[model samples]
Target: FNDGRIQQLAPPEDLYERPENGFVAQFIGENNTLEGTVETIGEGNCTVRLGDGSVIDALPVNVSRAGERTLLSIRPERAEFNLDRLPEGTHTVKAEVLEFIYMGDIFRVRLRIAGNENFVIKCRNAVGQRRLRPGEVIDVGWLPQDCRALEAA
Candidate 1:
């Protein structure tokens, strides 16, 4: 917390995969977390309605009900940018390329999604796409298993 009155303890993967609260989720890594409402829950999955009315499928962690508030966190490395074409029903969303931080192979893709300006999706420049321009809308997404739904703080 910015107040610095809190602390959490967890192993690496659990800290990253199943954050206990919004604070932990944001603190652990480079992540894009959005507040959402749970729409449904199943055996090992759940559907969350995001801010822009984009219903996203995610792996349930801290939420388990139809009307519960949850914070969804997705790491940049888990997302794919501008795939030639994705199969039907993939968890894709439209995001504008905000900025590109060039690394030798892996580059950071900052994006604006659903009017939120703090999203990012990192990719390998060695792959097909090497350039991304600011303000260019592109399709970006990750597997459902890679998206985590955590308890809203």
Candidate 2:
């Protein structure tokens, strides 16, 4: 992947949205991953407690048991910023704005969440979007369906 491409024979949407594994998720697009343990798993969703104690409600991509390690993969664009009030069954985590860059077409935000680095939010740079300031401590979230819960390893 350093200089070559990975070819995966997958449906276009699967490659972008529901990747088969971490390899595909990392290879096909920009994705944010978090390490955690499965807190609970029910009918259609799973709860994960991240490394820093942040809990995430995510779509259950694969069936897993409580206390088992898991991974949560979500795209930055799926991670909405301020103004999108955290809804029930959504993930809430504290993050500080490391840097916010306006790149014409979109707003690229660098964040430090729960001590994890390189966490980004590629949001729209439009009229209604929330403009963030560096050093701001804020709550960012995503809907359960927006994030996929996968095996940790």
Candidate 3:
């Protein structure tokens, strides 16, 4: 709860998958938050222009129309760098690999994305997985529904 008030009452899955506001989104888990302005609102989705002038489509959770300030929230694991791991037609942004950590079951990667140096993506340790190196540039993306547009914090 923010400031001692109940922000939302829901199941764990609902809270993680469908947070209601910026506070809950940040409070519950590790989210990559980027400030942006709503550029367009469409059926079930909206486009946001980030501070670095990169446009990304996201699910409109707390935004209404164009020009509304929003905070784009995405989970690290939801962001994929290897295009082969994602479905076709996914939107992508360029990210530079800053650091790659070999976790036991997952590869924790730090990336510079959309002007955020601390942006991170977790790749599962699997057979035939490609190892990323520092200074390598790659395309990173997530499904539109995986990104949530909420009130700017």
Candidate with maximal lDDT: 3
lDDT of 3 at 41: 98
lDDT of 3 by residue, 1-153 (tens): 878899999998889888988888887888887788999998899999987687888999978889999988899999998788778977788889999999989999999987899988888999988999999999899999999999886
Off by over 4 Å in 1: 1-9, 84-88
| Candidate 1 residue-wise lDDT, 1-153, digit = tens | 447665467788987776766777778887888778999998789998888988888999878789999888888888887564445677777888888889887888788887678888887777567588897888887778888888887
Ranking by TM-score: 3, 2, 1
Residue 127 miss distance in model 3 (angstroms): 0.9
Each prediction's TM-score against the native?
Answer: 0.84, 0.87, 0.95
Which residue runs does candidate 3 get wrong by more than 4 Å? none
- In order, how many clashes per candidate? 0, 0, 0
Residue 55, model 1: Cα distance from true site in angstroms: 1.0
- Scored by Cα lDDT, where does model 2 land? 0.81
lDDT of each: 0.81, 0.81, 0.89
What global local distance difference test value does model 1 have? 0.81
Tens digits of lDDT, candidate 2, 45-77: 888888889888888776469998877888998
Off by over 4 Å in 2: 1-9, 85-89
